[model samples]
Target: MSETTPVSELNEAEARAELARLAAQLQRANRLYHAEDAPELSDADYDALKRRNADIESLFPALKRPDSPSDQVGARAADGFSKVSHAVRMMSLGNGFDDDDIADFDRSIRKYLGLSSDAPLSYTAEPKIDGLSLSLRYEKGRLVQAATRGDGEVGENVTANARTVGDIPHDIENAPDIFEVRGEVYMSHADFDDLNARQVASGGKTFANPRNAAAGSLRQLDASITASRPLRFFAYAWGELSAPIAATQMEAIDRLRAFGFQTNDLTRLCPSLSDMLAHYRDIEAQRSTLGYDIDGVVYKVNDLALQARLGFRSTTPRWAIAHKFPAELAWTRLEGIDIQVGRTGALSPVARLHPVTVGGVVVSNATLHNEDYIAGRDAKGGAIRGGKDIRVGDWVQVYRAGDVIPKVADVDLSKRPKDSVPYAFPTKCPECGSDAIREDGDAVRRCTGGLICPAQAVEKLKHFVSRKAFDIEGLGAKQIEMFHGDPVLPINTPADIFTLQNRDASNLARLKNRDGWGETSASNLFAAIDEKRAIELGRLLFALGIRHVGEVGARDLALHYLDWDAMAQAIDAARPAALAQRKADAAEEAERQAAASDNRRARVKEARDAAIANSDVPPAAASAWSDLIGIDGIGTTLGLSLSDAFANPDERRAFDDLRQHLTIVSPDAPASDSPVAGKTVVFTGTLEKMTRAEAKARAEALGAKVSGSVSQKTDLLVAGPGAGSKAKKAADLGIETLDEDSWLQLIGDA
Candidate 1:
């Protein structure tokens, strides 16, 4: 849950944990999308999450999870009809989040091909259709079979539905004996609106978006239902083919067009990197007028030979990348600013704005992010949006980062009201009247009224039962809010939830007679709560909602410690040890910083050891602290957060009390048979055979734990050209060292 932690700051442990979190979240998101034909997460949020996952993988390739998000495609085809096993896999493209990602992509392509920067290269850029993927097969100019991409290798048969799509060619002239055309089945904005209006008139469930509408229409159980919807197909790619259609990407599109398949007219051929970027900008600028949803532009190496050489990753093609756009922007009047406290007590600022149409959606609220954001500064007080502060009655530009959550991108001082006053942020908790404090090195001001703050308590309760946590069916945000303020059955902490039914036993008549409550519903609620009494360790940890101890952190701790008592005992034992270490470290730092003393290193070590010797902290306690933080993915940041939570009397009482009612199940042991599975490895310098990331990934897949720096625990060091101080340290520590070739040989180059 390093949501705010920079990619560069992440260690292997944090990156791995975050990757696991992303895998589970993204998988659920994909299921909501493909299986349900609805988008639960916004496109922008999905891409952002994907980019975060990809970035972490690039940094810590070795820590990539077995269920890595990068390797995942869309959800498997929903169970219905017959499944079609694709002759060739239908792959996704790698994503380029920003201009820098594009640049890196280009660099990576060049490096992979061993070409110079100025080498001859050309690409084809096309609008990446936001729609359902379908593959159509033809035999001797006659349509034969059609299918939807089901998990990449398999798909659902949709030949009957494909015949009804107006844009699909029933028969093609002068075609190969066997040609498979692949493209996206989509609904235009006008068609989607018309369809929704018709559905409304007919009293049917309207689609969420054009993509959903198209997907639902195309995947109908009845072909007659598909024919009624105005669905369009854009054939941008081909699956299996009887013969080679063209030698280049642009030529292939042209061939597909000539074969009567509807192709995107906006597709273009670019001969250089600059052309690719310029075309992307051009497409983005004209996005709204396209009359169809397009998340981004796809760029592919035009040369067919180069593409063949490029091959593919586990899920994506190395030769192609999608350059996604940020959310659309529009001008809106900033009417007001509101502060809302989160479950963790961090106050967030939100803006109330005059409703404005942005990217076909009506937006009235924008995230101010924080107090610093409202004041036009970053975490370091650096200028943002040219240091322009936001105020009430000011005209501002609003945009959705993921086409869902709106944010104020910039302010227009020219339209500011003359009498506008500078707004001052609240210094106290708005809900509980407690002093809100911002600690040093922290960006957010948090409420000090932990249990007393109604906002925090309610939100925390909601989180405890959220889909990612305990997942109690009857307890949702609405229920949490009602129960938090209820006079007869008030829920104030995690413990309250478990003891709710018992507390209400004598008052069952009162509960059953209440508004929105009946005897049956009340019994069901209690049953739901009782069913979760025996919970997994990870779910319990995440349900507690301790700061920085998110889903990934909780899972990692659960995997390492196995049970609640083990983790709690370690947390308890680590506090004094951590304090003693902190004190000793401070004393040594002070000694070292004193004016250039002779034998500075010796004196610093002596000062540290002496401080540790004088302190009452036990060696066993120190070992416990080390072990707690040493768990893979458990770093100093999370370790300290755990200590702080346990150290606080209120959090400890709540956590312990909640545990009293639940049976915590130990996590299953993870067994890996890789040679390096238990060994710690440090990779340094330049790798010739593969990029540093790829090398790390390779080593990690074989069971090695990659570290950023050389340390005492390092069992091996993989060094290449320009091996630096890390290599020297490895040699000094007598750790085994391997060259690129030897390392590859050891792993059998798998």
Candidate 2:
């Protein structure tokens, strides 16, 4: 699914896959910021990913993994620096994206504190500095050591580096006997600009932003290098203290200021939620003039006692939340448009932009959505950007918000270049020269060429060896690309990967003799391949790179069938049944279209006839077909993708060839004894007790099969208000029906 795919629209399979992808993305983002000190994600984009992860977890709490995005904070300490175990962990704060989120935070605090809804709660709101977090240790008014926040608990020892930062006090007076003052090490806007200018003059490597500059400078292995860089520190927190400095948050900031530390003057003590919000706005308004980078406003309970009562939740303080700013927009010239092909043969259009900075990240490219979006229309033909089409050489406004890739939000006609022309999106795959066609319901055009196309073939191979799939440790993406493009030892398929060592054994020019390959490395590569010969059924299935068969779906199939033979036989038996059902579904759809538009009925009927006549699908055995899709959460839609993967001759041959090289492990059966266990359940209409996702998660957790629609195999239907066709169908089919309240009682959620 696209990053912009709505959370509500995603099915269980999609949600699971999306969550896995997000985990990898967020982890990489953490490394980029904390380890490498080269931040790639903008504040808005990073905030969006976290929000999406939270939303999905709320909806499907059962599927939440141990290493969820929420659990990640900073990366591990870098190689050169000595690791320091923190006495008190440095934690990240939860974020609030909107005004409602702020209100919810307040309400949650009040509820947790057992206060009335209208009870007044005081808070201290301060700018969330965009910089490297530093912990400065001072004992008896003398600085001793300093460290960077690394994976929360352990940090890089940078005592010498910290001493070079200008705003950091070498020694402070009137401080606690043991004080670990925590603060942000940042480079001011003016200093950063001047530093970059000097770097350019000397042909030195310049930093991407002030935050990165500060981080890189402060983490330098050489103290002299850090001394040469202009960095400032702002003391706002304390990690470990021998004695309490103040009773309130604001007073503590003042105390830090009094102890020869630079503290934000904009920090305010808000007596009410409105005051907090007002202060946030005031700080935001003054942000550009502040001379330093700040992404959001951090709000914390003012009273220390209340803060203790609120306590913490793993990585974040329950008493505080960061109210993040919205997406930032920047104008850039549209240089050109490029078409990129993926594993699925999706011909995605990307805008090549004149490099411009948006919220600290330099973006030279943006996703154009699709041809419809370039023409200023949505999938539904609705006007977007006031119907102004994007073109090469046009001045376009790009925004990075909830999107992983920046998008062209608006095009300025006033700055249109006289030589600009309408972008002609490619009609064929540039890599393989194959026809690219857009399917009826699909917004993006896709290349018709499948595995034969190098773009799709290489991408599929990459996915086959992805971290969540086969995960051949040495055969990462770059290695996969190198192996695929090898003239003699080319790995074209999953089967080819296994056969490589055997093929190389017979070749005159050996793999070890190749450039960048050593005898030990070659032997290790072969050993890694041999090590994975006996593979888990779920991993094997997922590694096949079958359409719609993600990690969770593969596991579902693995658990259901237990072994490979059973799954293959069932798929073979169900083909005929699926064929008959498809025709019936087509007729039903045509009849509905007849009511909506008389003209579409004939056209749809003709199309259905053409599809059926051309289809080589054999009739299915009703029982087998039902069992194939009957697995809980493996509904008809995902089942169809699974079926198609095996039903096709080429794909089946490839699967069998790959299977020959591996010993597959059968998954353990779910040992649930609940009343709803193994029952096919369907949820429909406006559920008042819980959301659709919550309902699905509950049913699945109790070992029930959750289906999106009603069928003859459906055992139960949980109907809420406004339940329509599904409810009537359940009644007609004699399936058991339950209300929202009844469902909750049955699932023990009540």
Candidate 3:
């Protein structure tokens, strides 16, 4: 498209079409740059495209597309890597372009908190390294996992690769039992030069830059390759800490250094915005001589409490921003579009761009979110860019800035090919040819192929064996995929996994003799599988990979049911009752639709309510729906997911088949020796000696069933300061009441 045509000159239809094209183009560029380590445009060109897209979107605010590139942070996780979900989602930082931008950021923060200009707000300024982000998860002072920051919420596990980096500690003394240390994994300029020289001498491919080299080396499937590369790590932030590391950002860095992790020595605490700007300039001046690549300076609010109060925006923290160096830009051609299916059955659209260079990196692909995104429509069906749409054979601008993925910045409409047509989204799953359905309130359409779809099946199996599920010792995503796809040793379902030993025994060919396996390993795997044969009810439920039944929901269900057989029986009985209730409601609705006499409608409604109240549910299942919804944290969404899974005939048969090969262990009841054993208890207000979580854990451990609200079943009430309705309810019921101190004394902790 010609740059001569002003964005304002474009009509509503033209703007909408252009916005759709730009959205698709930019998303493709993101995938290519972030996930594939390739770029098709320079940083400046990409920025220009983005600026143009923003201008049009501003003029036509009602047409802002849902898949706007400005809203996304990173691309989806690439294939061949095991995904790791972060406890605390890793977020991207907002950018500051210049000194004025830094001042604006400071002013914005102060305004958000209603603080005076002279208020003493401290910040920590550190160099923002141009490298890959890695999160090291430690449990009980031992490094358990190391993962790359894939898409904030989920990442790729790279523990083996991370272990090879000398700066990353394998163990830390006096560290919190559960902590996630976040930092940059980078390569020094000297090391990069040396590695490239060695590669040339060996006739191997050489890296274009230190950042790319470090990323490629760290993401290697082979640990030996990562170990051979000279990689260094610097601790900066943390996630999912068991306890507070320090009160301020700088102090937390010191704590990290004390725990044997390397921290940037240049990190400084700035008392004011001017001090932060000065530090940023100093870092910028020394950037070339720092031995490692640095893109900019990051400033974060020092006080942990203040940081917590500031909280987060849509995709970034309000407490911090990354002031990046100027971006580079370039132009490229839109090649084609492709669709990829994810583990969760989401069909993402990808852009194939003519290869170009942006910021010394090559890019060729980008992300296009979904159908609405491609059509210049928002997730809620609003027009984006006045219904602009992207088409093939269009000249697109691309750009990239410090650490951000390359993206399509704009489209040159003047160069658009006449024959190009608006892209049509597929209605059927490309992988399995099943009907692709988009649920209400969901942005992406998903394939309903289930087990019949190879992609969905493999993904489900991976989730089934994930760390939070069955957690089989030797069976990981890679092994599960290999076994499932193997013709001779197929593991198509949960039952198949259990019957593997039998299948192997029946055949002369052994798993032990296979590549990457031995007698001990095979035996150990079988032993692990056997150990999991008597899996806990909670874990079993989670391992089934039921939609919306997360670890917490599974645990709640298990605790309420206690016994496997009893839970299954209740579920079975509740399914029919739920059906009966639905039928009765339908009859009442039909009566109302018929415009029957008021008396007749009233009678129908009464009968419907009575039938629902007296549905055919076993005693244990009579209150199943109510009890499921009543559990603390259990909501209607999760309750429906559980009930639907139980009611589905295919799912029920699958569960029965799996149960035949394994024993589902019942969850243990609360301790019986304590004085409060088997007694339902409720805690109201606040306890001074301990937090609510701690109190609940202690009570459960001491055999008390801690209810959120006081009820007729409650035998004891522990009331602290500000005890209100719950305490009054206990007094009304004549249940025994005790102050916090008195409750502690009764529990033998006074």
Candidate 4:
């Protein structure tokens, strides 16, 4: 439906060939980037290849198989740790930009069940910690494995390093046979600063921030190296589990604490949205005081059943959302505004200010963002005159959003001097002397200069070799800027990076004579460059300088495609064919569905006659309905979401992407040691017989995974009235399930 021309059609053989080629190419790239920490391509180039591969798959849906190079989820085994396969796949959460998106998720839950708006709902509020995700597994009440959240199914083992954390328990009493707890691995603010100070003192590379350092440290090949770093853990979730320790989310936190895991004590339980908002505000007020990093507060539906009912989205759970705080603000004087041209010829405004502190750092300049951001008025209707025209004597408000770069918020009109006059915005680039044009619906005034502006080249080069890019060791942002436009070292593209090796001898010679550039460190820098020749696929993709592609996206592309050659070929050939096949499949599927519907209607008459002859419903009605509704852990919402997605043509196509790339290898889909495997059981009306929690635990111990409701496939349902709709649905489905009494009898008999 997009305006762009559809891709070409390809035969199945051709599609297969292209996919194969793409997989191999991408896989090689991934090895160089992720495993070796070197890069071969820019982010832009990688994104283009990914898009091409996606197009090919759109045409050839059947070819979009899981385990492709394009689906780069987990990396190869890290050197220092033993690898562990996850009992349950740890899927990443989907993101939302606004409150409306959250409300829509809530509505989806209602549509699945025939629920009205008044149905009471509650959510738990916790911080969305900005750090590395980890999984800790326990067996026989003893710590066994600690793993990074690799590809969701398999991860790098870090048990030895994890054991070093004082908060993690090495052993516990009365523990389940298997327990997998999930948490964030982070470096505390104080620890991060101290670590950086040490790095500076030792003349070693310092990380940009704590999050980066934590990830780097935890991923180190040596457990001893990880133990040396100031790392901490906070438990947030659980996977592969045996017993229920908590009745609610809050109680779960307490249980984790009792087990010797550290959890954020800042969590609060609120009765209403207003109260939740108040808590959010309180946290915002104390944001700077927190010892660790957090981007926002995550709100989750508190009730377990309700959360189950709300269920999960493809990426994130609908039961939870992150509420972010307002951007930090500060006041300062705007002395001047300068124009800088970009690679794409867009003119950007930079505001120069008298050095003023915002948050904790001195900011002498802030981004004006664009003409629209500057000239567009706020909700109160105050105009945003361009920062360029503001007189030198005027005061301005500066603000930083989510710890990002500062931006000019507004000009304080009250602080304007009587002698000040309104100045005109620039019509040309300040750096390149090129004509500037303003496009329709765009606030940006851009210069026509491309690859010609010194500022643009400097910024681009800096971004290209950034921490998340090629990750070149010697090329810091300052060094890149310093070399920019210098006649002696005029470097621009990624190719220029290779050229630097030629200057190694001369650079080392000059290093010994230069300020802050000693011979030993210079030698180390070149050696680091030599060490990064073989980059991984994902890192190569990230380094390509693509618009909108980041580290995570790059990784996704590599896993899905597998290798660079296959990826490149797919882009060059299969896209057109894949798209065409998708359209044909949609039509064929529709016809099949119509035929199936007709068959179902014919079967309905037979079903009615059979029901009348069987005639047991009159006596069975009461318990049958209850049994249908009494299955534990199953919810109507999840069922409905699954049904709707399967039923819709477009939704199916969209989810087809996940199917194409995601390799959900079930390690134990059919439980082997299930405690209640071959038993008939049921739960019934508010029994004090055993708490549902205790019963479920015992049943699982006996090899059972409890079903939410009764059905032909169900062995039993524990009934509780208010069992409501589930009971009726189960009876209609005609499942040979049992009730609480029968369930108890079997267990007692055992």
- In order, the Cα lDDT scores of the candidates are 0.81, 0.81, 0.77, 0.59
Q: Which residue pairs in candidate 2 have backbone atoms (N, alpha carbon, C) closer than 3 angstroms, thus clashing?
A: 576-618, 576-619, 576-620, 577-620
TM-score versus the correct structure, for each prediction: 0.62, 0.57, 0.51, 0.41
- lDDT for each residue of candidate 2 in 386-473, tens digit (9 for 90 to 100): 9999999999998766443577889999999888777788898998998998744458888767777888787778778766777786
Candidate 3, which segments miss by more than 4 Å at Cα? 1-331, 358-360, 381-387, 392-414, 473-475, 485-488, 503-505, 508-528, 569-622, 668-750
Query: Relative to the unseen true structure, what is the Cα RMSD of model 1?
Result: 10.7
TM-score (C-alpha) between model 4 and the true structure: 0.41
Please provide, for model 4 over 1-750, each residue's C-alpha lDDT reduced to its tens digit, 9 standing for 90 to 100: 111111232333455566676666666654544344344643323333444455556544446657564455435655656667888776554333234455664565554443456566555677778777888889888998888876566778878878877667899766668888899888889999999999999998888777778877777776788788999999978888887666678777777888888998888776555556667677767778898888667776676666655566544566776665444477888788666565445666677788876554467777766655555553233464543345566798876543234566667788888888654567877887867775332355766443455655555565556655566777765677655666765565455555564755576676555666788877777677666666666676555534334565445445434565444443334323222323334444444445566754455445434443444333333233223223344232222222332333433343333233222221122344543564534444454344555576567557554655455556556666456555665567764445666666766632
Q: What digit string (tens of lDDT, one per residue) describes model 3 on residues 420-514?
A: 88888888889999889875446888887766778777767776776667778888766886788688888887788888888756432478778
lDDT of 2 at 574: 83
Which candidate would rank higher by TM-score, 3 or 4?
Answer: 3
lDDT of 1 by residue, 154-248 (tens): 88899999999998998999877899999999999999999999999999999889999999888899999999999999999988888899999
User: CA lDDT of 531 in candidate 3?
Assistant: 84
Q: lDDT (0-100) at residue 579 of candidate 4?
A: 28
Per-residue lDDT, model 2, residue 513, is 86
The weakest ten consecutive residues by lDDT in model 2 span: 4-13
